[model samples]
Target: MTDDVPAQSLMLPVLLRPVISDLEKTDVAAAQTLRAALVKVENVHPGFTHDLVLGLVKKADLSINMNEALLRLQGQVADTDSEYRLRRAEEPFQELNRRSSLLKKILSRIPDEITDRRAFLDTIKEIASAIKKLLDVVNEIAGYIPGSTGKQALEQRKRDFVRYSKKFSTTLKEYFREGQPSAVFASALYLIHQTNLMIVTIKNKCE
Candidate 1:
């Protein structure tokens, strides 16, 4: 009904073609690079998995997000982005993204570090509950079958907890000694610490 519709419709396609072409090209290039980068899905920009997993854990209301975030933080270089995104050739965009990643890492830790350990403890509490339930089920349900896979998974989980707990202890010592960071930042930091500790404790028990 507008005067511009016919003209705009014709022009829109002309204008959009270049952009669509460019996007397709970018996707192809990125796909080629990623195909070469990962042997298994596990190697796909580990950070994406990490951010996703942390998000998932949080979504599930588990307390393990902080400890996982901390571990994810340790190796993350600012330059390399998640393998899934298209790599830009423009230096400014690349630099900006790299810097952005650093900020993201810092920001992500805030929730865990500032919040109280209650969330972290709750994660452990949940784990304890789940494990007890699993054991109960296994005890009640297992026939004469001898496969130890359930027990093995439990052991692996326990080992993971022990390793993370040691790291959490060291980090907590530094965290407390640093005098409470700003109030805005406090809750997140507390949360991170608590979550990390909870993850460690639960993982230890599961091991």
Candidate 2:
């Protein structure tokens, strides 16, 4: 749960292969179309996977906002439970938790697959921004609690970032060849190092 926690080694779902096979069997043309689109995107943007993750983050944000609105409406109509646990035990939190879990799973796939420098740096930037937004959403959700029940989770997010940032640093190192910072790859390397440092700083500042 903490930011410094090591990455979980998750196997790709067994159903994924069967599901894709079923899709190919059921609608070959649609499956081909999907494949073509993915290939095109991969050709154009090597970092397309990162973009996909960012899109998921946006979706999560929308879900959170809708949940907030619903809670507000519920509040206006009738005063609900006083305890945070009771509220968190509801549908909205469950949905948010699901989204968060999915987002993390997708993100965990990126480092191993994307090796290009430009794509890697771009992915790192997007991930940093997305994670910041996610933590903010966490805080907002916690605000619904009467006390500080949410503090641990928020702190854990910070520590998780620390671990993720270290992972980024390691992955970036793989693509970096010996060169002056004047070159594009070197410049990217410098920027990535800075970004990792910034993540460390942000994590340290979290209470």
Candidate 3:
């Protein structure tokens, strides 16, 4: 049994080179193309929904760190009339901080379930709800901008921004739902479709 095992191990290399060299050459280019294609696929899919969630969390942090601090200081210096506004700002900051922490952790775990299209789509919807809440907080802030014209414009822009983001979020969700990138990844991948063109251009320059 020991002699048979040694003889079998020695024969392993005999069938490898001719088979491996041709296979490796073909696969290497394919792998490169797939890698490049994935980048294109990711970009065309637009701003990742996961990033938007993190972005809102960051925005919430800014509101807590900067705006809330300013409001508290302003309240201390103001007449009693403005105390309510300071309280309002402080309340939302606290609530948003809680929401943001939950969201940050949720975002961290997303890459694992991202391959499941249904879950990925659901996450898009969930993040959109969170975004809507963020925009609502912004709208509340806009109402207190201290001047008639500026406050009106701020409110207008807030509405427009919300509308724009909703459309973008929907488009990204649709792109993932269609599952085109996964299909493309499974196929050729096309990491660098212009590789030959680039090589030829480089050769011409050298010549």
Top-lDDT structure, candidate number: 2
Q: Give each model a TM-score.
A: 0.27, 0.34, 0.35
Segments in model 2 whose C-alpha atoms lie over 4 Å from true places: 1-102, 105-113, 149-153, 156-207
Cα-based lDDT for every prediction: 0.38, 0.39, 0.37
lDDT order of candidates, top first: 2, 1, 3
Q: Poorest 10 consecutive residues of model 2 by lDDT?
A: 3-12
Better candidate number, 1 or 3, judged by lDDT: 1
Better of 1 and 3 by TM-score: 3
lDDT of 1 by residue, 142-191 (tens): 22223576445444544543454444445445565774433323222333
- Candidate 2: lDDT of 90? 52
Residue 44 of model 1: what lDDT? Answer: 48
lDDT of predicted model 2: 0.39
Task: Give a tens-digit lDDT track for model 2, residues 134-169.
Answer: 455555555443434345544565565456555545
**Can you give the lDDT of residue 97 in candidate 3?**
35
Q: Which residue segments of model 3 deviate by more than 4 Å?
A: 1-89, 93-112, 176-207
lDDT of 3 by residue, 1-207 (tens): 122221122111111222333554779775556545543543565323323333665977753322122212221222221111122335553343333333323333344445787886676566556556655555544444565766655555555545545444454555566844332211111111111122222223222
